[model samples]
Target: MNAPDIIDFGERLLVPHVIKGETQISAEVEHFSRATQETVMTPKLDLDALVWRRHEVGPAFDTPLAEIIDFLDAVSEALDYDKNSYLQEAMEQNARIGTLGARILENCYRDIATFFTREAATAEAVGSFGSLEALDGWHRQSIRGAETDIRAFPPRMVHILAGNAPVVPPITIVRAALSKGLHLLKMPSNDMFTATALLRTMADVGPDHPVTRSFSAAYWRGGDEAVEGHIFRSQYYDKLAVWGGDAAVRHAMKYAAPGFEIISFDPKVSIGLIGKEAHESEESLANVAERAAADVLAFNQDACACARFQFVEGDDEQIDAFCSALQSEMGKNTRYGDGPNGPVPPQEAVEELDMLDMLAPLYHVYGKPNGGGMVIRSSEPVGFNPSGKIINVVQVNELSEALPHVTVATQTVGVYPQSRMGGLRDALSSSGVQRIVRLGNHIGGAFGGLPHDGGWPLHRMMHWVSAEV
Candidate 1:
């Protein structure tokens, strides 16, 4: 892979440029961060120019929906990991700016194309609007006394992308194309290159295409009031699609007014619920352990969907055995993780475990901080966040007893014994859990037209306009 002009100076990293629509914005503005002590040089953003004019927005909205799909298909071809230059650049620079390892990051980048498909694109429109015809043009519907024609129009949006998952860039790009919206992506500090790399790939496919010209990706510090104060108003952008991080979402909320709406994918937690049936036999216990391990190993527990907390129904001896089995199973290979011994837990988590170990009978720690997965069987929930293949298992009298821990911040709950889900799903949903899945199947499809972070974002990204005659 031929690397870009990005320079790493041990202390300071220089990102070569930013993407402004089909144009490449060079290093014109230098930003210094006192927090990270890193200086970033990118093109100066013309805050006024970021907003699309009435005439420019019209061309994008009028572009045939099929044409936009074709453009996205071409983009999918450009993301091929074996041949795409942009992804190659991403693979090279990801280590300095990303959280995942080289092998895991490559696996994610390769799957980028799957996120863009006719089925996936149209499905989001259908799922959001009941029919694809709503996005193509006005669809007339018969009413009791009056006939109404309704259509979905794209809104001008600013996508604040979180870099936790590498595939987010393509997801945002496909959604923007499908909705036919004007997008200005504010790149996060962790993984800044992928989004700009994607826009550059689109420009290569069709530089003058309306879709390509309707997109831009750049970077500024997240809370820079000077830049955000000007661009976040309703006059400049209609929607703010903020992803990940509590601070990012809170800062974006300050700009949300009556006309400007914030579509937030806030930070969330996921947990696993195991039934006593798992202990029906040694084999049943082993199977449950394997499934629980896979959920914890997802992105080494960095992803929101990865199970960090677990509630189990078993006696003290049985629960202790399950923890040991779970830690052992996590050492084996899974789709999201490879080799033996998973990543080590974060330092703070390890310190908390160490402090808890002194409590003896009240708390038990399985597996060490060195790696290979760790489980903290606690009488109550731990305070520190769980990460790096760590799972906190709390024994519960019944699965529903764990309901109090489930809140609006809970994104997914993986329950054991498929039949148990039928009993717990309603209560789980009412308690603010958006998704409930079979114990071993916590990871699901990422395509649109699906429930995400509690709402349908594609539907939120559009302006539902109606006319009556």
Candidate 2:
């Protein structure tokens, strides 16, 4: 059957001008206010046509960096929650995450401004390439009496977006533009609207502009060989920037070769560390519990950097008191306005906790099993992944005991008592943790200066070409 021509672009649903692939198929994708079934006609894979479009549009994005910043400023204003139809549509289609609060949407919008700053971009360019001159044009530098002119060239990139956070699409778009790449984005099934909406906004900035023309966004079943096989070829795309779980990362890795590179933002877990000061006074304990709650419930704990397990150095009574306070804090709305995702925990998660409660003497349960914020106190880390607002509070004699659990997969560690960070930061970094932040701060918010997965992405995304004189 021929698929329907009309496609949902989050806010503005319309018919696509170009289609690829021969097979016509329908997919059940989430839509604003309802679940809708839709059809897609696959246009035949044309590597030459795609490459032509990339070269045609690449020059448009090769403008001055200030122009790009101005374009992004317009996008940021367009994304304002009160006025943005696409964002409104996003809030509706992604009800599972959007319903958490208005502040969540606001925060997503706020993150856009952080990326386009001149200071931030310059710092990233310098940090990654060792000089900003490479960004403007080729720069001459001497090494061991040899002179080389280095220029940062934009590569042809494909971005596989993750839907866990709404801010991802805009961030990806900014990176692609900054690197001046011929970019294609594959939106996740859970979030079909965001990338399209942002791209539409970009087109609105300058219709037929190179930055707009150089971009393409589409969706396909992840492992479909008919589509992936053609696009994943080294001759087609220079880099694959992926953000997903282990399976998705592994799938992309299989396609990596000499000329084709895969930069992956893989699945990671976060935890919180509490020092003995948390038990010294009621005020201190209350502060620690509140901070821990912020880390646990941020983005409904769906963000990889959100803390799922907290290790506390305190007695049973002290730990129990903190848990009681944490339970209360999790249910209450914060300044960011997020609360319990739902009243009930996922059945599988509850079952796992219950079995642990029955089989293990070290496990202690707090709050209701039906959610409203639940906590499990244990002597060691729980065997299963904690989700649905369930936090594993493992009691430790010293915060150092939790270091063994800190692997390369650990993304963020929230520590209490600012001074304690001096002692633990080195050990935690040595253990493979990426970020260390004070408890209560949102772990996912970017200041535009932090390294993602240990490196500056834009620097890595570009091909550093050098000529010897």
Candidate 3:
């Protein structure tokens, strides 16, 4: 059979053992492929089996934390993409459905194992809750007149995952296992097979384990009312851990009834700020430019944490030099598995830059518009979003001038000089930026146990119940 036929024949969803009787209905999995700029259909799902019933909550909630960690560690060991047939199949299927290329996907799959280690799982539990004891059972505390016992109880949740990055599935899986929640992953079209591949790997390691049985992965059209309208009810799920574009979030909001809450990871943008100190010497300028390149080129600028607009403090001459150097640095940095030519920008965006280049002095366009990576410097922020390894370097008199441009939609800001961050952090926080990091550190520096989008997600994934005695 051909690739498409094989994909179509495989049933993508897992039918939990708790589910009894036959399938009431079935549907084809469908989604738009951003990679091919077309619609792609893959496999079928037993829709009735995807729904969670209150009485059918998996034993994961009551399973001891240490055992849960052990299960997760075993899952980590089983995710070796080279050895596992499920992941190897996922690698092949995802290459066709996902936006990322094969090599990048392999790297992401390899890194997924790192997050599932016992050390990492324990850290997640501790970071989310002050004490790991909270997840085990109610811990006692005293008030002025009364004593209270509080526990972080798992809630039945549905994670509407995004496909921009392939690592999201494993991230959600880790969070769900740590929180001991009943999870139903609504896989995105761009990359549907990964979550199912992960769960299948876990099943191999622990077939009868609670954590293995706790997860269910499926893909339905994002706004399919017949499917969503039924499972999105408060009776079926307590929380919806949503992540996607604006339309996806809006669709989920409609289902946010009295009891079913939405923990939204809204679509966001990131920016960079460079202080005047960057121009104190040629070496300094070179160093900052290289750092700036790392931020823009990360995940080929597809990540929300990747900086799109950069605010620099310097004269037009100084800025031009930095822009030229930044463009050169972007071409050299391919650590994120970018092609030799780098990411190709959209033809429309390149055309806009071409027009801007004709009006020189007002706008400086450095590097080729091709996948070689380009830097566009303007006195004001550009009108469009930058991607395809493109970075918009905006001129600023001082780093503080960039503060007004920051908004709630801004997720991260990478500052050039370490000293400048202390002064701007308060204003950046007030303006709604969730994370602030030094230049070149956007990829590894801003993440881990930290508040994401504006909140601690692990905390939000569970219900903190208390009883006064």
lDDT against the true structure, per candidate, is 0.79, 0.71, 0.79
| Candidate 2 residue-wise lDDT, 168-270, digit = tens | 7877887777776788788775566667666766665566555676677776668778778877777778889999889889998998999889999989999
- What's the TM for model 3? 0.91
RMSD of 3: 3.8
Candidate 3, position 345, lDDT: 85
Q: By the TM-score metric, which is better: model 1 or model 2?
A: 1
Clashing pairs in 1: none
In terms of TM-score, how similar is model 2 to the real structure?
A: 0.87
Q: What is candidate 1's lDDT per residue for 281-336, written digit by digit as tens?
A: 99999999999988888776777888999999989999999999998998886666
Best by lDDT: 1
Clashing pairs for model 2 are 19-43, 20-42, 20-43, 21-42, 21-43, 21-44
Model 1 residue 182 CA deviation (Å) reads 0.4
> On residues 1-469, what C-alpha lDDT tens digit does candidate 3 reach at each position?
1111133334332211112211111324445655564555544655667766778866687889888989889888887767777676677667776667777777777777887888777877788777677799788899787899988888889999998887788888888988887888887877767877777777667777888777787667788888888888888789998898888899889888899999999988999999999999999999998888888876678878888999999998899999999888887735563644567888999898999899888997998866778999999998999888888999999888888899999998998799888998999999999999998888765124667788888999898899998
Quality of model 1 by C-alpha lDDT: 0.79
* Per-residue lDDT value at 219 in model 3: 69
Positional deviation of residue 116's Cα in model 3 after best superposition, in angstroms: 0.6
Total clashing pairs in model 1 = 0
Candidates 2 and 3 compared: the better one by TM-score is 3
Better of 1 and 3 by lDDT: 1
Error of 1 at 288 (Å): 2.1
* The 10-residue segment with the lowest total lDDT in model 2: 16-25
